[model samples]
Target: MDIVLGLQWGDEGKGKFIDLISENYDITARFNGGANAGHSIERNGKRITLKMIPSGIFMKEVQNVIGTGTVLDPVSFKKEILNLQLFDHTIQPEKNIIISKKAHLVMPTHKLLDIFMEENPEYTTIGTTKNGIAQAYSNKILRQNLRVGDIWSPDFQSRAQHILYRDYKMLEDGGMIVLPALEEISKEFFDAVDFLKKFTCTETEIYLNNALSKGKRILAEGSQATMLDIDHGTYPYVTSSSTTAAGACSGLGISPKKMGEIYGIAKAYCTRVGNGAFPTELLDEFGDDLRMKGNEFGSNTGRPRRIGWLDLPALKYAVMINGVTQLVLTKADVLNGVKSVAVCTHYELEDGSLETVSGTLSENIRPVLKWMNGWSADFVNMKSGSELPEELKEFLSFLEAALEIPVTYLSTGPGREQILKMK
Candidate 1:
């Protein structure tokens, strides 16, 4: 199976690229994350933001799988499936989509707890989407969570109630007030659980292995990005789960040896949502211009993203961790009007020593930028690398030499067809 994931923080235009490339694969499976991750795709002049569903859902020939390592919110899943069904009448969720039975369900209390934690003054907020991802994963690790398969069992409702009350007690003990009534929340939760039962739920690990044995091509779609991985990313500022290529194995139940190409997706520039140590962040008017031109807003939260120049050191760190074989540079057209483009190649410490991305980054570090002349060509409508301007070609060449990775794909705009396959 091949993997497609973000190399930067998040919002690296992964959805459009996945949708553009899914035609070659028989299956496109989401490996990690939940409703907190949004992939927006535009096709036929209409656009839709996908949360839990894989971007390949628009393609009738490709089967989309929600794998085991993900946490599912029944309400959000139901809403997404219904929305896609209404958007395209040809999409039959029961026929083309598969939900892993081992996937954990996100409870209402999880979201409540998420809000409580973020609102609490005693702790530093990670700027979560308040989707209950961290709380849901906490329940999973504690073995007090509900799995997708549990909805079919006789004690499903009882088990869910037990966990809900447990979480409520924990929250109350933690000084949380203004809790929603149990009856009101349970009604909606159970209703969404009922709605979730109509879909195909099975052991996806076995099914995926069987399909692999049959030589079916599988595309593992990663949510979030490598820089947000729980263990590998910047601590406390990272997501709840792994978002690297190795995550596809445990997330989708595929063997590491079965992995093929790793497509690392990033923007021509960089943009991060929420808070973190951003060494190359642009604070000037050009930063605002990049945001306006690229439309750099969070699809899930609708918040403005923190814009910056491309950090080559961080990109190289992501490539190393994910074992990225090829790169896909996106949003190059966003840089069309610039006089020069800058990329950060290294970080200079307070003592004036240069360092690569060896560990977690601090806010005090300074960036060493390498600037190149910008291009003015309208490459959004261009389809071939031969049509690319000499200036843009020079920048890409420098990137290829620095990372030792081939630029296989380039996306100039948000439209699905705006991408060009360079290789």
Candidate 2:
């Protein structure tokens, strides 16, 4: 069985939930996104940021794999592995994890392009992390990218020289001054490639499929949310890759028949990173409280996130795309002290029309909110759905009713033990 999520924005506490569920699965594979994803898991009272690595890596029995559709930031990935090694000595390339050889490598020039694009003040900013994810994917689609397998080829140096010359010429043509060659760039790139070779697998599709035929359970994890999907999300502000459930199949090389359960994850409220149209966003003191209480900041970029109330149009739209079988609501406790809360049940469009949640309507309309009394109760150390405050239960019930999905999992805090399996 494969469990997939991300009904809301990127930081839906996916890492903690995936870590909690990893014990039941034989393999955990991350399908999409790049190092720009910030999945933080708290275990043994310690918090770790997992970018390229799967959040399930901390499990002793779980085998983690990075799928081909994901763009590789080898330097960041190497540092993450080394950081994990600091806590446990048993993690090694040959024993626990694997990387797809087909994954495109992120070059230094990609980072430069990312920075240049984000720093252009005249253009509308998409609030990127400047992590070179867009540039890496762009090169891949342009068919000018270098993959993991190319690092060991005899022509690697020549290929590098050719790529550098092309990139430098393009920058010069754009009237931008280029920096001098630094040895650190080559050293980091080569070192990352060498490190990745230890775990590169050419036939990830065959490996995963064969394992599935044996009835081995698998978990397909997504990095960003459906609202950030490039083709389906709000235009000019979405991520570079697909962030929906269908992406799970294309990203992991899995068949639709192999997909067992789809879990859509959302917070009790909503939060988004970068610049975009947020219909239900709160700009008052209440929004400030949600930001501070939830520690709502980008895990990868450390940028402050935009806080808002629940948008049902967005949630229902995600449900339709992912075919969500179950819902996992995170940070419900963050709304504990509020006097009242709001959920956007419908949208008021610019054309004076009322529409249900659709991607196009979301871009053109403003939300129509429904208010409810807030729940004031402490959820810390609480372990079960029965123990939850009555008001909190009411909130979840409303969410289920509005989205027509069951709420099976609830997360109160960042720690592993904080999750409650309600269903």
Candidate 3:
């Protein structure tokens, strides 16, 4: 009944928060996105980076479901579930997870399309993860994609072959000579398709509603963040899915009336990956320092993230769009040991006029900042908000008041036990 999602671009430590609070829910489901999402979670001193799998997989009691709105890559998903044992969580796929029958599969040719797109800089590039996400989603929109349930159909092989042929032809149109060998790629693709055929698949909309009638607690997890939403975000620089709360209804097929609190996860600072108009970007030594301290690297691609001061206007916009009920601050202690910190209070427009952020931002706008004192305390021995440094508390209080939301959860470290709740 509860929802957890990111408010920024991505990598707001949402997976960490989901894993930390997943015990409260009986069912945890991922609504949108695919392998492009990299949720890095630390458990028992080991880091586990999940691509297609839900973050709640670490909890033995939780039933994780990948909802129909996802564009799944079956082979990578199978490997992820099979490799969980190496991380000390031996997940029984049939019991621990289920895939929605309506979910579309990421074909091998989708990767080829993605490769073709990313390789061609002549077209506008969103700096995609190149995990075939856009290509897969495009096929779904065009009704040319294959669903997970199609694997069980009698004519699946023919259907897939036809789709592959169309994709190959599309690649040729895109000016590629050496086409992908159908026999070679389909070998692994068909085997994985068989695995998916045997995997548990269901009509999750009915399944979720039925469980809700029985008083089950459901937690819907979102991929990317609000700012990455295709419709509501920075135009060509955004992801190819609905990452906002609206995504929960579309992706999971759950009604908004059944929803509980929406928890928006954000870092103390802000970050973005790839190219975009970042109004508050710190392009100096401070930016580099923050990146080094937070280890701001893309979880999926290992590409360095663009770090910036926390933009209140952007966060406020996200909260407004998502109808976020509460806020969870992650990496609060990353600001520790710093001498000063800056927050974006307003944006200066091209006319030398200051305005609260609105509309699509451009590189011409500049952020007006408010500087604050930083805390040097490590917070390792601290167990509660009362033990937090006074400076840190004041800074958080300022943010809460400005954003008009309570900061309930604070993540001090990467480990599971390093988090504390305000309540």
C-alpha RMSD for every candidate: 1.2, 1.7, 1.4
Q: Candidate 2: global Cα-lDDT?
A: 0.82
What do the candidate models score in CA lDDT, each in turn?
0.90, 0.82, 0.87
Better of 1 and 2 by TM-score: 1
Per-residue alpha-carbon lDDT of model 2 for 1-423, expressed as tens digits?
A: 576778777799888889889889999988888898989887677777888888788788888888888998878878878888886677664577877777788877677677777776756788888888998898999999997667778998779767766775676676656564535666676787678777756657777888898988889889988888978887778888988878888888888877888988899899999888888888998798789999998888888889999988889999998899999999888888888888988888787888677675345677888888888766786878999878788889988888888999999877788888999
lDDT of 1 by residue, 302-333 (tens): 99999999999899999988889999999888
Clashing pairs in 3: 1-218
Kindly list the per-residue Cα lDDT of model 3 for residues 144-219, writing each as its tens digit: 7889888888999999989888888888887887454777778888887777766679998889889999999999
Model 3: residues with Cα > 4 Å off, grouped in runs: 177-180
Clashes of each: 0, 0, 1
Q: Which pairs clash in the backbone of model 2?
A: none
- Residue pairs with clashing backbones, model 1: none
Count of clashing pairs, candidate 2:
0
Which rank order by lDDT, best down to worst?
1, 3, 2
